[model samples]
Target: MRHFSVFGAAAFACALFAGSASATQEPQAADILFERPQLEKLKGGDRLDYSYSFKSADPSLFGPAFDDRIGLRVEPGDGPDKKKVEVEMFSAERRRAAGPFEDMSGNPLLSLMLEENLQRLAAIFQANPRYMKTAIRLALRNAKATPEPSEGFGDAPGWRVEVAPFKDDPHKARMHGLDTLTYRFRVSEAAPGEITEIAISARDAKGDVLFEETTRYAGKH
Candidate 1:
C-alpha cells in the first residue's frame, strides 16, 4: 500500500501490484496519476472536479491497456453556512486497445476492471481531507507518506476528509485470475470552501477498500 497528498500540477502517482501469479507470468503493476482537483466557480458556490490517468508500469508484462479517466463533482448546499453538499464521481474509458481485453462493452472481466479503477479513484478522493490534516496522520494511519503541498485546488485551508467503514458482505473482485474480497464504506466530508459536507460511498464491487486508512479530518471531532 502507498499514499501521498495530491495538490497542484505535480502529479500524485500510485502503483497497483497484481496479486500472486504463475511462475511463467510475472506480477505486474499499474501506475495511476491523479491530477489535482480543478475548481469551477459557480454563481452561488463552486464545483470542484479532478481527473485520474493510468497505464501499465510494464507494458511488456501487461501488454497494451486502455487508459482511464474519472470525473468527480462537488455541489454546495444553499445558504451561507451551506449545510449540505452533493458529491458524485464517475469514470469512462478514454481509449480502447486491440487485445484480449478489448471490446469491454459487454465483457464482465473488462467491465469489472473499469469499475474497480473508478472505485479506487473515489477512495482516494474520500480520503483527501483526513490525509491532509497531519502528515504523520496520513503516514501512520493511511499508509500514505505525505508530500510537500503544492498549489492546487484541494490545497485550500479548512479542507478535510472523513470515512466510515460499513459492515456488509465482502465483494468479489477478480481480474485476469486475481481475486480478492473487499469491504465498503460511506465517505463524506465538510471542508473549507462552499462544500459543507459531501455524502457518497463506493458501492460493493465498485471498488476494493482493503488496507485503506480512513479517519475524520482534524477539528471535525
Candidate 2:
C-alpha cells in the first residue's frame, strides 16, 4: 500500500555484469529495489548473506535445481568517505557484482541479486540479459507495491511488488512458452539486506509450473 526501499550481493554482467541498471521511481521502495543504505546502515566487520535456490520444472531444459549463497563483504569504500561492499556470488566464477553502481557508498548487493536473475532468463531465451532487464525496469516503472508481512527473515512491515513483464509481449511466441512469467519481490527494513525474498516462475498451458527460482534470507550464517 505504501512505498518502501531493499538487497541480497552481486556481480557485473558484460555491462550488466559490470555496468549499472535502474528501475521505476518510487522513493523508499526503489531505493531498496535498486539503491539502499544497507552499506551505510552497516559498517566494517559487518557481513550479510542470502540463500539462493534454482528450480526448473524441466531440469533437462533449464539445468538442475541447486542451492548456493550470495555474500557481501564490507570494506573500504572506493571513495575516501564511504564504505564499500564486495560480493562473492558464483564461487566458480568468483564474480563480484553491483549493478548500476557508480560508487560503493551504499548497498549494491540488491542490484546484483536482481541482475543475476535477468541474466539467467536471458540465457534461457538466448537473448541479451539487458533485453530481459528492460521488462523489470518497465514493471518497476509502472508498479504499485502492496503491503504484506515481511516474510522470511524480515518480520517487520514490508511490501511486495509483482509484475509479469512478458504477459503482453508481442514477442511471446519466441519465449519458449514462458511468456507468462512473473516476478515477485518482498522487502523490508527488518532484514539484514532489506530483501526478504524473491520469486520467479512460469506455468504451462496445463497449469503445471514450468520453472521457479527463489532467493531468501536464511539468517546470519
Candidate 3:
C-alpha cells in the first residue's frame, strides 16, 4: 500500500485544486509556503516530516536579509483529549563571533564588523529551506520517542523529544534583530492522520501579532 504523510496528501489535494485558471494568476508573495510532508514507516512506528518557507510583507524594513519567522504547533485529539506538543525547529539565539581574527587583531571596530558579518552568514544558513529541512529530519531521527503508560488510561503512546536551545553569546547583537522561532509536531493514534486545523501566525518579540491565519486543513490524508 502507498502511504503518505499529512503534508504530502495535502499537497496532492492542492495540486488538484490548482486547475488551469490558477495558471493565469500572477505569483505574489505569500505569508507562508509549505512543502508536502513525507511519511516514513520504521520498525518502531511512523514519522511525518514537513517544511515551510515564508516571506514577510515588509522584509526590507525588518532587516536587510530578514525572512519571515515561521511557527508550527500540533495538538492531538479533541478538546478533552487534546495535548499540545512543543517542537523546537529553530534556534532563538543570534550568531556569535567567528574565529580569532589574526590580521585585524587589535582593531575593535573591524572585529565587531567581522562578528556581525559572521552572524549574517549564520542567519542566511539557518534561513535556507534545504538546511532547515535537513535539520528537522535529523532531529526526528535522533529523537527518543518511547511510548509510556498513560495515567488512568492503560498503556498509551507517549514520546518525548529534546531540542537544544540556541547558545547564548555576548558579542553578537543587531538592531531590530529578528526574533528567534521554533517549530514542533504531534501525532495521536486516536486522531485522524490528517491535520484538522492549520494556523500561521507572526509576532514581534513583545508578543504583538504581525500576521495570523487559522483555518481547517485543506490537504487530504
Candidate 4:
C-alpha cells in the first residue's frame, strides 16, 4: 500500500533490488548521479525495458502524452552483488508493482526515474516531497558527467547528466515555472540495464515544452 511514489515502492522485487532508499539510486554516468555500481553489471533473466514517455504543456494541468514501461526481471542472488529484482510499472499489460524484494548495489533506473519525477512534482507544485527531495539532492550532488560516446548506438559507452534542480530556487516564484526543470541522464554500457537514457524537461519564458518525461532504453526483451 505504498505507491504514493517518490518511491517507497518495493514489490516485483523492490524496484530492481536495493535500488531504492539511499535517496533513490540508479544508472551509470560517472562522476556522480547516485554514486555507482550500475546494477551489478546485470545477470538473471536480464531485462530492463524502458520507454515510459510523458508530456505536458498543460494537458489540463500536466497530463496527456503517455506511455509506460520500466520493467525489470533479474533474480539470482546469495552472492556476487546479491540481486533479486523485479519491477513493472505504469501498466500496459505487465502490471507488477506490489512490494518486497531487495538486496544491494544501485540501479533501478534510479528509483524509477527520480521517484516518478518527484511524484509529478509533488502533485503539480503543492510541493514538499521533502522539499522536492532536498532540491533533487542538490541537483544530483552537483552533477557533471559528459563523456558522450555513441558509435551509432552499438558502440554505446555513453554519459550525459544534466541538472537544473530549480535553478537557484530560493523558492523560485513558488515554482510556477517549475524552476525550469531539467534532469537528463543518459548512461550506457551499450544498454542491458546500464540506462541508455532518462529525461525530464521544462520550458517557458518563451521557449516551449512546459513539461516532458522520457525513459528510452528499450532492449532486453
RMSD of every candidate to native, in Å, equals: 18.7, 7.3, 21.1, 16.1
Top-TM-score structure, candidate number: 2
* Local lDDT at 172 for model 1: 18
| TM-scores for the candidates | 0.25, 0.76, 0.28, 0.30
lDDT of each: 0.25, 0.63, 0.28, 0.67
Query: In candidate 1, which residue pairs get closer than 3 Å at backbone N, Cα or C atoms, i.e. clash?
Result: 3-144, 129-160, 129-161, 130-161
> Global lDDT for candidate 2?
0.63
Q: In model 1, what lDDT does residue 115 have?
A: 38
lDDT, residue 164, model 4: 87
lDDT pick, better of 3 and 4:
4
lDDT for each residue of candidate 4 in 1-221, tens digit (9 for 90 to 100)? 33534555333123233333444344422333444556677877777787788888788888778777767777776778767776777685535453334664556566667776787778876788778776766566555567778534865667788888888888788788888888887776656656677788989889888988988877775
Q: Show where candidate 2 strays beyond 4 Å.
A: 1-32, 78-81, 92-102, 152-155
Lowest lDDT sum, 10 consecutive residues, model 1, at 27-36
Cα lDDT tens digits, model 2, 65-174, are 88788776766666654666656665554344443233465456445656666666666668865666666666665666687787554356887878898888888888
Clashes of 3: 5
